[model samples]
Target: MDDRIDVASLGWPAGLVGELDHRRLKAPSVKLRSARAGEHGDVTYCVDLRIRHPNADEYLTSTELHSVEHFLLEGFQRLLPEHFVSVGLMGCQTGFYLGFVNEGRSEVLCACLVRILEEMQAATVVPYANIEQCGNWRNHSLDDAQRVAREILARREHWLDAA
Candidate 1:
């Protein structure tokens, strides 16, 4: 392994760069892709959720990121059952990625996330926080997740920023 490698220099999966033009999608909503999405030719769509502001901690604390992961994983499954692939946090904690099957849906994925963020804010407990249910259960915080969700809900138009 190249022990000297810098994580900061490798922000996103290089495979993702070919498809998403994240720089121009700052409007209130971001439409799903017209072209196929996936691992080059694998047909899975990926949505990279980026934190816009400078305060990374405010947007994604460790506890909050864990809670948000559970929420998005479940929420997207319920909303887009057929298309939702998976969700995961970035190592830098500045964002997360949502993956799904590319069905070429006309709806905006980012707009749909706004609704989900509202639901996350209203949740009283963090799901899958028990030791038996999670790897680092004690490291979760519903409060932090809700706070971050509230900020995201308030913004309503923050798009994925380019790495």
Candidate 2:
């Protein structure tokens, strides 16, 4: 068996990444959360999502971890789901993650993000906050999450460079 990580074969998990990619189907239903003027010329909004497994136990509670995910998701959804490019959980951090490669200007993404933040503040239900934080963020450390984000970001950078 090949020990090497097959970067070429990797696709963002369909449930999360792939599901969001079908923007056309979702766009109409996606509500605009907020708006702002532009600050940066090229940046997209980001969202975090957390889905707890049915097998959660006492040791697996990480409000901070789940909080970040809730922060991202509600924030982005309320702000700008259209500018979304990529969505995924960090390979390491419980749910520490980012949304990268936005389609338009940073200013646009920021405006949307502001709306998202507001929505987050108003949200009543947060998915993963109650779950036990036993899993090591997909079983890795913070360093691992950073590395994963960097690698994924770089890959998108390469794709943009190619285009």
Per-model TM against the reference: 0.67, 0.33
Q: Quote model 1's TM-score.
A: 0.67
Clashing pairs for model 1 are 37-44, 38-44
Q: For model 1, give the 10-residue run with minimal summed lDDT.
A: 1-10
lDDT at 101 for candidate 1?
Answer: 69
lDDT of 2 by residue, 1-163 (tens): 1123221233222233222322222210111111222446443323332222222331223433444454555455545556554445544332333454433333354345444444444455443333374233343233322332333333332221110
CA shift at 49, candidate 1, in angstroms?
0.5
Model 1 per-residue lDDT tens digits across residues 1-163 = 1223222233323333434555543322232222343345445555556543323333467777888888888788888888788887867666676776643232446656877888887788787778888999888888888877776666553343333
Question: For each candidate, C-alpha RMSD in Å?
Answer: 9.0, 15.6
Top-TM-score structure, candidate number: 1
Off by over 4 Å in 2: 1-61, 87-97, 100-104, 127-163
Local accuracy by lDDT, each model: 0.59, 0.35
What value does the lDDT take at residue 70 in candidate 1? 84
